[model samples]
Target chain A: MLTALELIGIAAFAASGALAAVRSRLDVFGVIVLALTTALGGGTIRDVLLDVTPPTALVTWPYLAVAGGTGLLVFLFHPTVAKLRRSVLVLDAVGLGLFVTGGTNTALALGAPPYAACLVGMTTGIGGGALRDVLLREIPLVLRREIYAVAALAGAVIVALGDHLGFPPEPVAVTGSVVIMGLRILALWRGWNAPTAPKLDGV
Target chain B: MLTALELIGIAAFAASGALAAVRSRLDVFGVIVLALTTALGGGTIRDVLLDVTPPTALVTWPYLAVAGGTGLLVFLFHPTVAKLRRSVLVLDAVGLGLFVTGGTNTALALGAPPYAACLVGMTTGIGGGALRDVLLREIPLVLRREIYAVAALAGAVIVALGDHLGFPPEPVAVTGSVVIMGLRILALWRGWNAPTAPKLDGV
Candidate 1:
């Protein structure tokens, strides 16, 4: 079940990355590169930080195949993909939720402290999109104006708390994921934005 | 000698990152964060890829101290630092050379293939700066039209070749570092630019 959800997340992120590449007018190769980066970049960073060498995504051929295939599909039919922006955004929220919960669990399994695990979970949830935006030469959307990181952090905290309170891992993970996805989707629908830093003069 | 050189490299990269953050008008905290990222990001990535657990930079307080100290110094005396742009550029080249050589040797020691070692070396040389540029919302200078990656790759290949032919490590490392630093400095002085892709129409 986890594997299936991970694959779906990878596909969603890949599509989003490919679309961004297309919008940037990148060639086919660039689109595929971005797709792979977006799908695998977060987990790769998380694994590395957790001292898991040869990151799981790199060793697992299925992840690569899924991400690359989705890139190609998006590139070949970008107009159709673009038309599904709303769906893609929804799917992206699902991906974020899964990544946050999974990342928190993975860190905990690796013996990371609760606070550190929460940070890692948040990083995993947002790392891919931040990387995609960076490569596209834009400020990361999460760093700019979104409830995105906050949503991820909230879910991560819940997962950490569940672990601390002796809750079953399975139900805890499900609840955490649901909360993240719901919050993200709600933020999108309601046009919610995170507050930006106030400007100061004469620094 | 290697440890001293690595410290110098870390300090140089930290200063460079801090300067960039100041130029971008980031706050003091931002300056420090960018400095730490630039000084350690490349080696951190390289270590993870090479499957080294608990990255050396994270474990060694000296690295953090040097990077953070440099950041604070730059933040406090940016004007003096900015006036030394030429010197900083030279120091940056030195850092790049050290990182490339160090990264390649580390990878090779870990039984990585020569080609992979070379790529990791180049990444170690350029990754920090790339992250800095991305955070500042600019295309990475290396990706744009610099001979930066080429110089690093050349140095790495030379080191790999030395290892393949069973040369003693010290002289080979020195020779590699000199070659990378020389190429980078010469490129800067001569305004050498890497070739860009030709324009293509209609995908």
Candidate 2:
């Protein structure tokens, strides 16, 4: 079931990436590459950072196949998918929430400290999107005005808190996922931005 | 000294990044961010993948200091630095060559195979620039028309082949570095690009 959620997450992100590539006016191959990167970039980094030889993607052909198949569809049906911005964004948020939960669970399972688990969870949720924006030569949404990663961080914090409170794993994960999704939706609808450090001398 | 060489490499990459930012019409903070990312991004990824605690820049105050100082200088001295595009590119090539050797050495030292070592080398050499391009929202130079990382891979292969032949590390690294730097210079002078796979008909 967790793997199924992850596959859904991957498919959503692939579509999101295909949208970004279309916006960037990339070719078919570039679009597929971008989609794959957006879908798998964060998890790959997490696996590598953990030194978990062969990374999850290498061991899981289904993940890539789903992402690639989505990309192929987006390429063939550009006009149809172009109007899917709202739905795609929502699905991407689901992926973000799902990944945050997965990452935090993995870290805590690995015996990391609460803070470190939260941090890794946050990273797993947003790292790939950050990579996507960086590769596209755009300001990372996470680093800038977006409240995206903050949602992940919040969910991760909840995971830590719930574990500390001795809550059951299912409740902890479901509650955290819902919270992340809610916050992300609020952020998207309200255009919420993290306050930036002001310029020098208050000028 | 290795320290001096590292600082020089940082400055060279920072200057190149600043130049690119200026060309793209970015602001002061943008300039600094790009400079630092281009200078330190590759090494950061390498360190993270190796799971080095606290990471390299966090470990050495000097690396961050050098990168930040170079960013400041490049931001403040844009006009003079802009005139050195050719010189900066040459230095960039040399710096990348050195990074390839360093990455290969580090990976091999960590007991990785030649294939993994070569990958680490190529990633370290080109990863920073690729990260920079992604942040700038452009197609990465590595993904675009450039023989950049190919040069790094060739150099790494030289190191691996030489090591396999029972040569010492120092001589092997030096030979590989020189080879990468020379090939890069030749490629740049000749405006060479790696051949892309041909596109399919009506797809």
Best by TM-score: 1
Please identify model 2 stretches exceeding 4 Å from their true place: A4-15, A26-94, A110-120, A134-203, B1-11, B18-41, B52-84, B111-120, B130-203
In terms of lDDT, the best-performing candidate is: 1
User: Can you write out model 1's per-residue Cα lDDT over A16-127, one digit (the tens) per residue?
Assistant: 8999999999999999999999999999888878877789989999999999999999999999998898788888888999999999999888877676687678778888
* All-Cα superposition RMSD per candidate: 8.1, 9.0
Candidate 2 CA-lDDT value: 0.76
Residue pairs with backbone atoms closer than 3 Å in model 1 (clashes): none
lDDT of 2 by residue, A115-202 (tens): 9889888888888787777777767778874577678888999998898788987779878988998988787666524354433111
Q: Give candidate 2's error at residue B54 in angstroms.
A: 6.6
- Per-residue lDDT over B1-203 for candidate 2, one digit per residue giving the tens place of the 0 to 100 score: 55576677777777777777876889888988888888888887766655565668557878777777777787888788777766888888877877888887777777666766776677778778876776666687664433675688789999878777889988788888889889878977676343533331000
Query: Relative to the unseen true structure, what is the C-alpha lDDT of residue A117 in candidate 2, on a scale of 0 to 100?
Result: 88
